[model samples]
Target: MAASMWRKMRTYVSRKNIHRLIFDPQCAIFSMFLLLIAEVAVNILVIKKIKYTEIDWKAYMQEVEGVVNGTYDYTKLRGDTGPLVYPAGFVYVYMALYYVTSYGHHIRLGQYVFALLYILSLVILFDIYRKTKRVPPYSFIFMCCASYRIHSIYVLRLFNDPVAMFFMYVAINFFLRDRWSIGCLMYSFGVSIKMNLLLFSPAILMLLMVRFGTLKTLLHLIVCAVPQIVLAVPFLLENPVGYVVRAFNFGRQFFYVWTVNWRLIPEEIFLNKYFQTALLILHVTFLILFFVFKWRRLYPGVGFGILMKESPTALSPNQILLPLFTSNLIGMSFSRSLHYQFYVWYFHTLHYLLWSTTQPPIVKILVLGVIELCWNTYPSTVLSSSLLHVCHAVLLYGLWYSPDYTPNDKNLTATKVD
Candidate 1:
């Protein structure tokens, strides 16, 4: 059995095979072609004709108009929507779009531009996975193809979510290389676009904590947080109460009846302030425990050495990052109510986490089926909502406990491509 295992390992990482893969341009071009085709087809067939006319788009367009005319007032832009819920940095996207459409109020044209940006977002995502070289090419391609929720977030809704996501992933790619300051700056900018990017804050915090001292980590976090503060200053100056209400409106009641997280629970229970408080407390506690466990391998050699004696201090940081990314995103999914559009925030990363596991094919399929069913349903049903959270919990549990790759185990990563 030992000999057979050694033989399989050798075959998986043979130097000769790695060299051949490095020069495979045909494979790279084929992958890019397929990705482009998928993006174009989805935009043309599904998104263009969808009659939903996302209410959110109307609100965003109003803000865009206000900005372009030099009369931008977040407090009064979308009267029906209460106020602009996002930071002022997003005004720039609409400003550019407004110019592109020749101020003809061409919202559909803006959607097309957003669709292109979304495609670029996926390209950056693929590049990140390629740099990590852990996910299989076929699996990465499959996840990219299956991202209908992400597609809707982009072309169908013409959301600010994708713009934030594009920034977040670009930051992740930088952070993966230990470029802490630049990554945090990008993350900060993403947060400025839409605060939903804060869902991944714990992951960034964990990564920073693992590599640097507390003082440096704190400094970096402050640097990261500065952009959002600066962006909000003008809005706050004009209408302090409005800015406060809109920017940090977590306690606001859900206006929509159809939601992913709260759909399974009774409506009263879902809306209860106490229930929300309990979830927040539990989420914070779970995150603290997660952070501690992640630092176990780096614990002091003075007194705790015996406890983590078997843990490898020399292991690559990606092992820690994968869990940080998985746990926080799953935490976000369950710790708060998820609207129909929120799925895009973590779907791609969640798929990567799912496939990273050694779960059986049947199990992965069933889990994916449950997730897809939940998101694909327009008005999410009770069963789909319940299963969605259940599936998230399962993925979080599996990723939390999954074995980390050792020096030998990491040899199983995808081969380099030239």
Candidate 2:
């Protein structure tokens, strides 16, 4: 009887039925339950070792309360504390949390809520991949079981990166379905949460323009701007310049030790204004060259035919561009004063991009295993700055070279799996 049952189970899990097993609600539920337990264990370990107060949760709470009470002064905040760089929508999230936690006195409650949100974000991400039907077998499972480096940054450290990434993922999901307006709104909301998202704005706008044409794209952009405008009304009326300068220009230079590249360069280089200017110009030129060459190879269009041809569908251009843009942004962030927790931003994008490819399951597993090793070593002394720089460079290069599946592909059938 035992031998017969084993044979039956093996037969049931064959390639043809794998999809059913993978997407089954019961499977997802069980995976999530396991993930929750693991995450809770990790969170407990981190909080105990690092100490809750050292992570800046209290300062973040104070900042949010300050914004809610209308006593928030941007200029003063930036001067006295570090940059108050997050968007108004982020403030709202914190405010809601504060209200529920009774002004953050209930730290455990806040941590629990963030933990749940982090888990929910992963579920939504899996749903988005499942909707594509192109997600390789075991991809979602790998993502769930991967190291805590990225997810912990949000859940344990209590940062807004996860929340912003959630919006980005939602926006991409809507965009994939050709829901341009809603996607644009979500994109706008993501940007409103953190200016880091501004890096993706141009790509999102390009996507809208390609999908809806110029006039309609402009109208959609206007509509998308409404939410941000409404949220900024008070700040705009009070001290527009201060808000703009603080929110936009907060990270204009490098000062912190946690920033990645800054640690590599000499202090003299960072202190010199001209050196910074030169580095900025060099970085911009390199990125432009990379994109130009990439585009020329991937999609070469005739004059009028370009507008008429359908946009790339194997993961929209935005999906392809986002990971690259985010990697570069993380590089830039590291070149400035990046906190240890800020590494979450890059790892999240990197891990997602790795799993999203059409590569074989073994290849995905191998790559993720390497990344997991690196991530696990990050907090320890084993992973040095030079090692991290190389890893990041490799991931960014992979992102740039990875196929995003344009509509121009001859093999793409009418089923449209992307």
TM-score for each predicted model, relative to the true structure:
0.81, 0.76
> Which pairs, if any, clash in model 2?
259-338, 260-334
Q: Give the per-residue lDDT of model 2 (tens digit) for 1-418.
A: 9999999999987886776546453345444555557656665565556544336667767777677767555654531246577667877877788899888788767777877777667666655544534444345555654566665676566777777777877777777676777877887787787766665664565455444556676788897889788877777777888877876674476554444444455667657877766756755665565445543333334122234434443334334344345434534533444455555555445545654455555665676666555445533232444455565555555655656535364322323344
- Model 2 vs. true fold: TM: 0.76
The true-versus-predicted C-alpha distance at residue 376 of model 2, in Å, is 5.6
Report the Cα lDDT for candidate 1.
0.67
* RMSD to the hidden true structure, all candidates: 7.6, 5.1
Which model scores highest in TM-score? 1
Error of 2 at 378 (Å): 6.4
lDDT (0 to 1) per candidate: 0.67, 0.59
Q: Give the runs in model 2 whose Cα sits over 4 Å from its true position.
A: 1-10, 14-53, 76-80, 131-142, 271-275, 296-338, 355-383, 399-418
Clashes of 2: 2
Q: Show pairs that collide, candidate 1.
A: 22-418
